[model samples]
Target: MYENNLLLERGAARDLPETILLSDFLLDCQVRNFSPRTVQSYKSNLKYFLSRHPIRISPEDLKVFLVHIRDEKGFAQSTVENYFAALSSFNDFLEWEGVIERNVVPQFRKRYLRQYKDQRNEERQLINLEQMRDLIDSAEWICHKAMFVFFAKTGIRRQELIDLDVQDLHVSKRYAVLKPHAKRSNRIVFFDDECAQVLETWLKWRYNRKIRISALFIGVQGSRISRDAVYEAVTEHGLQLGFHNPEGLLNEKFTPHCFRHWFTTWLRRAGCPRAIIQELRGDTRKEAIDIYDHITQDELKEDYLKYIPKLGIKL
Candidate 1:
């Protein structure tokens, strides 16, 4: 397990003290190809437990720790469930290593009992064609315009956009490579003609300027733009266009994940096959695509044209 620390040279949290056992478990997760985000969440949950409940003993101590979280911390049922998951994994590792004889963390399920009715009927909050046009028209900077165009058309997650490399954009294929360190490893996402045109224009303008950064989106000093910058850009744009409010709305409600949601939802409304949608969105399960992917391009075009102005380009 101590050897596991070497593999985490790039990813481990520096502020936290090193643990041979914890490092080993994390290394195992990495070997399993679990998404970095999932690994981080699991690590965070385990770290929080270790920080608060620092007692070293047999497996029975774990059961006592769970009870304390439930009875004393007043943590939500879901949060407690996550804590149980973290500890359960740790206990299993200890046993496998022969450090402990038994595993005692009880498995528990999480449920959210809503007091009020679900608001799903509320119109799916997506940027319609008109709102999208307004957003593009109002963008004052080339960077902001390019960023909005990239997301609105490609429908990638925020982190994916942050990690995007210039080489990832396959202009000939009309697709962009979305290879994030977390979640979906590498997915090919296609874009529309208008977005391609917008990006080409931006690239031309940028090329003439003397920027030598390899990153698609460069910040001051020619550094790659961070995820936070993209978040801020989208949030400000949404607010300026009255698409969403700056406070409590815009990004807080619609986040970078929402763009992917919008894409999936739009594809469903447009009548794309569930299998195709799943393939496009990099979803592992086909059940959701089956449930939602029932529309066709013709039907979707008819529905969308009612809201989205004439694209002039045929689908």
Candidate 2:
């Protein structure tokens, strides 16, 4: 089935060069709408394997590779998971293309990324509603204040915030369009009027200065802000506001995704249904994501308004 790839004789899977097979697998990943990051991971991991191991892979060889990475390389649980995922997908692709007769990757699933202990409870990374307001107050600049407000109120992922454009802010509707990031899934997220006011104020200040950039958020130099800058800004303010875990014992830092989690947790505490919260966060549940389509924006907004605070306007 690798029609465009090297024409290997039937049952001659070992004769196929790993690079050529990897090329075919990568093309398939692209066709299947895998993210560029994922494709790159597959390419790098497979090429690394080829660099170290024989072109022809067997179940026995795969077991050795796994041990080498997990034990010898001292890979963490997540790294081991990622490596095997790459291997599994690559093997599946080759098997599907008839290059291999058996799918051995599945048999190795139990050992791959195996964990012995239950997940450790890291301090609750999210800020409370009061802490959120305090975090916003800790911002030194108008732009930082607006960014803090949006992150706290909107609950969008950091990447979504980075990809945000000025045009995506529908201030009049009190919502922002979160363009698809991971999985190419896009959805609307709502925020309170307090956020709207700050964003509008920022826009006014931004326009008055004649900064022609189209980015929604800009740094001191009037260019689009980098992800690291946003993280540092949040962390810097979070520490000042004393954002610790539930026990309030450790100096836990808040992350961008924390806002998203904070939003869900707050919504749940506010009596919003788990299904609706999942819809807002773009997470699919078994009950069917389409069921949420019946929940109108007006209803969503009304439910959201009941929970988030209506902060006083800050210019």
Tell me the TM-score of each prediction against the true structure: 0.65, 0.76
Model 1 lDDT at residue 146? 73
Global lDDT of model 2: 0.75
lDDT of each: 0.62, 0.75
Report the C-alpha lDDT of model 1 over 1-315, residue by residue, as the tens digit. 666764354234322343766787788778878667667878998887777564244445555665677778777655766766677777676655555566655432222222112423334357766666677667777766777767766667777777777788876556777775455523766666676777777677778897667788866456888767777777677776666654453334444556676666767767765555665665555466465756454443344323323233211
Candidate 2, 185-301: lDDT as tens digits = 437888877888888888998889897888999877778898788887887777667673333532265767687777778878878876567667767555554654576777777
Candidate 1: give its CA RMSD in angstroms.
Answer: 8.0
Evaluate model 1: give its TM-score: 0.65
- For this target, which candidate reaches the highest lDDT against the unseen true structure? 2
Off by over 4 Å in 1: 1-18, 37-45, 55-92, 98-106, 109-124, 180-186, 219-221, 246-252, 285-315
All-Cα superposition RMSD per candidate: 8.0, 4.4
Whole-model alpha-carbon lDDT for candidate 1: 0.62
Q: Which candidate's TM-score is highest?
A: 2
